[model samples]
Target: MKLKQLSVALFTAATLTAGSNSKADTITTPEVITKTTSAFFNCADYEVVGVCFWLYCTITGCTVKTSAKVAHYNPEITTQTYRNAEKPPWVETRVMLDAMQAGHDGSLIGIILETMGSGLDELGGGAGSENKAASHSNMTFTLTDSFGNPVLLASKVIGSSGYVCDPQLTPMYPYYVSNLDTVAWRFSIPEMFYPQSLNPFGSLLGSNSYNWGGYYPRIGHVTNHDLVKESGLIAFRSAHFLSRRGESHVYTTIAQNSREGFWPPGPLTEHSGKWQQLAPKGETSCKTFPLSAGTGPSDGLSGYRSDDGAHVWNLWRRYKCCKDRGDFLYDIEW
Candidate 1:
């Protein structure tokens, strides 16, 4: 049983009873962080699969299919910094929508977008050039009702300032996003196991190189080539591991260009040494460094050394860098 199939089955059983309010209208579980769990399913078990708003929903009997958009945030930088000092020069926000399915069992859909409004004014000065509007990212979950109408399940707001490290400005103390709120309703699915299933409702897909917090040197590298050039070295890989516990982390490798071939491979050359270092070889911990325009001290090294001199490597947790024109590699191990 794949996650999508299980979700559809649960949805069908829950809604089978006729009533003025659909079973989905009410959440039986309390809204607590611990209550959220990853649901699994097998696509081979279902005849049809659908996704919406990054939520995977599958139907065994119905043919209705829907698409969804997974929103993303675009941050504008006025200036760039490699350290925790300078303030970011300019800031802007953009949104992206991706396709999703609604049938995945125990699957959840959410959106992330950077927004500007009164929320910025509350930070300090009124909306002015000097006091640019504070940017926000909103993650929303969506689902379909008994009638198959697309509906929003839940939403949460996150601030941009806290996540990025600036070189100049004093670090904002206790960085926090002020209007923190959660949607009253959330989608629910059945419990099942599914593998190699297409989760249209979730933003991260096998085709995408970057995971939740893992960074990619460029965007197009994972989704398309054109966008690759526009992507900056991963400032940081988002903490996807924590968000989706129990779910196996997937890593994809890119072929090394001629320039990359010249560099000495790291200890984990078998698995793209650089990626192993960033993601690590085990389930305990995974971390990657911030990427800069030029190579740093750790440039070109095939493996990463822990503080104790332990060399741990894996392709899934590696990162690559470039010098004048050659290739450099870095690994993340714990």
Candidate 2:
């Protein structure tokens, strides 16, 4: 019943609902405005009646948003960050191949990671009303622990520019890599971690003190570390939650549960060749997404970029290495 593993009926209904309301959450720096009052002027505002009110709010130092302010994207979840606080549970982060984007390279598989964590058995804390709930994050954000003090993240992905968590995720969306030391990427949760709600993605994570973004994957790294310096802040971004309207964003909400290890897409098993579970790869768009650097064909797909000299092939939703043009080995006829 989880968002990722929802029944087809629920999934279709939810997707429909979400598609209608999904809009980017933009956060901008408060604009600087000079209030002015005159015979025919008011303060400009969100809801404009005339020039009178505009000048009033401006004179009161309450003018509406000003163009002088810089635009900042908050990516706020707006609501519903299901964190596990009663008992801080250790989560799992794994890498798997997205067969949906597979090709002759045996399905380009690398460290595109996803973490699974737990949530409240029920809507505990003030979850029912505007997220006034005191859940794991709100409770422990100030308290110091092994991972040191944690910061509340409204969205799963670190929006702080220039900061990258796992290279598999940022700087480049993870793609096909061969025989690499994939062991460098593993993460878990600590006893006291940040619980964020109203975040872009309803993820619970333990971030490092640097807060700017991330640390490179290192060798001999343990899956779950006891110190922030060792582990850094890890996120469970793939979890999903059921919405009150019976609709939910596919990979943003998580199930309020009593236990952990609830795979975002369901339990997956590794087979000799590929993973044996059916999970829609999170963020599985082709290489055309902005900031994408891969070895896709130059003329392949729109918005898709070719390799950055990394020798990596970029398949912009096309799985075949070469599309058949029906120009078989037949003799050429004019």
Give candidate 1 regions above 4 Å deviation.
Answer: 1-237, 240-288, 292-315, 318-334
State, as a TM-score between 0 and 1, how close model 1 is to the true structure. Answer: 0.16
> How many pairs collide in each candidate, listed in order?
77, 26
CA lDDT of every candidate: 0.18, 0.17
- Candidate 1, lDDT over the whole model: 0.18
Ten contiguous residues with the weakest lDDT in model 1: 89-98
Best model number under lDDT: 1
lDDT of 2 by residue, 1-334 (tens): 4322222233233324332221121110110000011100211111211111111133445432211111111111111111212211101101111122232233222222211222222211121123445632211110000110011121124422212111111111111111121222212122113234223233222222212122111111222212221111211111111111122111212112211111012211111001000011112221111122222344322222111100011111000011112222211111
Mind giving the per-residue lDDT tens digits that candidate 1 earns over 201-287? 243222244323212211111221111111112111112211122322221111222332122122221122122121111222222
